[model samples]
Target: MSDGDEPAVTGEEVRNVADLARVDLNDEEVETFAEQFEAVLADFETLDEVPEIESEPDLVNVMRADEVEAGLTQEEALSNASETEDGYFKGPRVS
Candidate 1:
């Protein structure tokens, strides 16, 4: 679509953003994106008209229970390690 049929979001801004994003866009694509961006912004602006809630709703934990479970044994865990010591994987010591 041409910029004439598009809303207020400018093609220059779209092109600038595309440049910033390292996107390779031609003239037609920039104009189309500028129009789309304007429409999207208008849609999001409707959220501003929604009435504010007076109080917060109760919130609760929604997670799985944590429990100890059997996993790979020490020897199995360190089987791929280049070095192991005292049933633990060994790595270079850092100061």
Candidate 2:
């Protein structure tokens, strides 16, 4: 949508986005982001006017063959760990 047609983004909306993104933003930052968001929407409006190209390159999944190769031995793998438990690296529990 054009900037004129775009709905105003309030400080509450910016704050909500910060919360969802797991970031903290003060009131001034929220107001600044709201203004920046309006500018970004205006830039998007310009992009909407660009003509679509018919010969765009299609994206394809590129992968390599998966083959088994020699890897570290049990002793070598656990050698660098600060602690080991039953031939495995012992680390702090995630939970």
Candidate 3:
């Protein structure tokens, strides 16, 4: 989409975003960030118009050898617990 056709980012929009994110923003900060966000979105729009790239290597999941390793014993694991019952750490029960 052309830059002129793109929706303009405004302070009200920024404030709405901040409210949705549970953030507090003063009027001045909102105004400043609205301008910054508009610039960033314009840059992203420009990038979106570039030709599709295919030179990158295909993504592959890197794996490691599966092996069993020695680990902490049950007693050793529970040793630091403030409370334990029947070989397991005891915690407050949820209602």
Top model number, TM-score: 1
Candidate lDDT values, in order? 0.85, 0.86, 0.87
- All candidates: TM-score: 0.53, 0.48, 0.49
**Per-residue lDDT for 60 in model 2?**
82
User: Best-fitting candidate, measured by lDDT?
Assistant: 3
User: Model 1 TM-score?
Assistant: 0.53
- Report clash pairs, candidate 1: none
The sequence of per-residue lDDT tens digits that candidate 1 reaches over residues 25-88 is 9999998998799888877787777889888888888998999999998778889999988888
Q: What's the residue-level lDDT of 73 in candidate 2? A: 94
RMSD for all candidates, in order, please: 7.7, 7.6, 7.1
TM-score of 3: 0.49
Worst 10 residues of 3 by lDDT: 1-10
| Candidate 2: regions farther than 4 A off | 1-7, 56-95
- Sort all candidates by TM-score, best to worst: 1, 3, 2
